[model samples]
Target: MLTEELLTLAAAAGAAVATAAGTDAWEGLRTRLGGWLGRGDARGGEGALAELDAGAAELLADGTPTRAELERYGAAWRDRVITTLERLDGPEREEAAAELHRLVEREPAAREVRGGDQHVQGGIRVHAEQGSLAAALINGGVSFSPPPPPVRPEG
Candidate 1:
């Protein structure tokens, strides 16, 4: 059974893969991911590479993908990563998770969200990125909480 941490790592890796696709990072990421999934098997590595390339092609088929498309691809890759992790043994699984975590950290999109103020209400936060608009509708009573004051370093 995969641990919660490993599962989260796999999900992040999937998102990273989706984000890296069609970008300059795609080549390096694809090669690393293929090797990670391959686990010393050349045929497995080639298969993984092919699958990743196909996914990238599909994602970029329409030039710029929509948010929905990115989510869809991310979910598919997440499932694939989860399945891969589930099939691995203990040490290998840990190693793979670590590698995936590193990849995700290195991915620009996976690392940060650059945009406007994020508002959290009822434990839900809405984020808007550059050249994008995001809106959330909440039924029932809505409360607006002021953001916490920034901490100042004491001299």
Candidate 2:
């Protein structure tokens, strides 16, 4: 089970590649994602992905990551991400699509961001909002309604 942060990072990477297009960073990142797509199995990069996952998780746990490495790592995650989202259907799919759009808009590859250089032109993107705990609860398939209050006195 992929973490929400990972999924979000993936989306952001997609956005970066999308806006930048032909830039080296975009191409490199796209290449990595393409590798995943080409392989059709993120499970293949188990070791490398695990190392990255652990590193990212540690940074997140420390809550003190504000650097370029994070961005690159994030960009590297879009491959498995967009792939997974592709498997869904209906409302969930729509939600993922909307999230991807927003991500692309916010992190448009054309605009000069802190990390990737301004060079590329266009690349594939699937901006997606990282799911939150609330979203998870909603999607948990558990029905919940306010419990009936104590019987009111007959008026």
Candidate 3:
């Protein structure tokens, strides 16, 4: 098992990767991250790309990922990251961590708007909170909450 800090880092990386899907940054991210996760192995990189694509496809089909679904993906990738890191020596692990950090830092902020914010891929559109978008595609699922109270001008 990874230490608490490492697990957190893995989860963050997973979330960042998830957020980058279906965006302009996705292709570059997909290739670079796949290469990293694959440890320079072409087959491994391809596998990673497939996984990323499948997740994006799922989101497109469902329209939004449910909270549970996003968590599932996050957990899945987190475990993968942890496993990959575990196999590395100290220096390699540090380098991987640095790379992951860079990836996370580069992710765009999430948008809460309704229209243009949707991520379109292969002509399929999906709308959800930015970072949380990965899990927005819960089939037949809908979430509702009261809108925030309007702000009043200072008296």
Candidate 4:
């Protein structure tokens, strides 16, 4: 039987795989996940890659998938991971769990921002909505005044 921690790790791996699909992190996650599932068998690794590709394709087919759809895929992958861990022997299972933990640790969190020139020296939050754009380059602090009310046509 798998420990609760391992089971939680499996679930996190599943969610990470699902979220990483179609993103910059997908390739690395896909390759590592294929290796994990393959367990040193070349053909098995190839097959796993094929399966991962198919899942990613399906998830991205709509271009903009709803949150529910993402969750569905996440759950499916989670079940797959749990099943894989369940099939392993004690030592193998432990090693696989450790590997999976590493994979999860390396995965970028959702909405993570990265850029070469961008530097954040302190906490910053920018929110844009309703066809507006917001940006900040804060070294110390900043403030904003509300926009004037929308114009009304003359009577």
Candidate 5:
């Protein structure tokens, strides 16, 4: 039976792996995750890499993955991680858990926006000969104003 801490780590790792799939950070996360799980074993690391690739590919191919599919992937990775954790000795388990914590803490890729309120109807053309082309500079430090007309005293 897994302890509370180990169970928490397993859950987090599962979510992180699933969230990372198909993201820009996918490659880096996959490499580090594989290496971590590999535990300095070349063949193990290679196998992990292969698994990550296949999972990522499957997730991406779905276009819009269902929640069930996501859960399935997450559960699988969690089980794999739990198995790995169980194999290690006490100190090794601590080290591996620490590494997994770091991996989870790393930032994930930015999500892309699907839709926006922005609309465009016609082309916009602006020609600037010299200093500034903007008609108005709002909410900025720089301010632009026309020069004051030449002061004239009474003749």
Candidate 6:
């Protein structure tokens, strides 16, 4: 099994390759990540993307990633492509890389806010937090707690 760092790197690489080599290349990642994802399976039939869907809930639910982090991930992949081209010979290099760059420019979803975030990671946290807060007052979820003392923690 690949380490967490390797898996994240592979995911980022696959995303880049999906951008450069197109989505077809991402299938390899699906297969490679599939087995690892399956290790935790109780059902033994769920797909990698499904596991990712579950994982995204945990990571992104905290908050949306800062725009800068997303930008850095994209930039690093583009740089990898650039570095690859720099090592190649001549016209063929430019032509091939140009094609990949064209594909890159034609990204399937130019600005999708992917993964979980408060806005994107809907369902549980947003609903639960709001519901719990409301219930705490009305349903007395915190009924056992004493009234605030005059010398308060905040003060």
In terms of TM-score, which candidate is strongest?
Answer: 1
TM-score of every prediction relative to native? 0.70, 0.28, 0.61, 0.69, 0.66, 0.31
Clashes of each: 0, 12, 7, 0, 0, 0
Report, for every candidate in turn, its global Cα lDDT versus the true structure. Answer: 0.79, 0.49, 0.68, 0.79, 0.75, 0.40
Ranked by TM-score, the better of candidates 5 and 6 is: 5
Residue pairs of candidate 6 with colliding backbone atoms: none
* Candidate 5 residue lDDT tens string, 1-155: 66876776776777778878887777888898999989999999999999989987887795967888877987898899999999987888889988887776673311110112223344334567778675532343444467689999989
TM-score of 5: 0.66
Lowest lDDT 10-mer window, candidate 3?
Answer: 109-118
Task: Please give, for residues 1-155, the per-residue lDDT of candidate 4 as tens digits.
Answer: 77777767777777787788898999999999899988889998999899999988999998977889888987887788888899998899989988887877787541122122334455456999999999866555455667679999999
How far is 28's C-alpha from truth in model 5 (Å)?
1.3
Q: Cα RMSD (Å) per model?
A: 12.1, 19.2, 13.6, 9.6, 17.7, 18.3
Per-residue C-alpha lDDT of model 6 across residues 32-143, encoded as one tens digit per residue = 3333334346453265455443433433455654555445544544344344444556675545444443443333332122222213232222235644643222332222
Q: Which ten residues in a row have the lowest lDDT in candidate 6?
A: 110-119
Per residue, candidate 3 scores C-alpha lDDT tens digits across 13-100 of 6775566656787787777778878887889988988987887777657766776776677667767888898998778888887776
Which regions of candidate 2 are displaced past 4 Å? 1-75, 108-155
What lDDT score is found at residue 16 in candidate 2? 65
Alpha-carbon runs more than 4 Å astray in model 4:
110-155
lDDT of 2 by residue, 35-150 (tens): 44334456654553454445446545655455565555455555646565667677766665555444444445413432334343443234546663332212223444675799
Q: Which of candidates 2 and 5 reaches a greater lDDT? A: 5
Which ranges in model 3 have alpha carbons more than 4 Å from their true place?
Answer: 108-155
- Relative to the unseen true structure, what is the Cα RMSD of model 3? 13.6
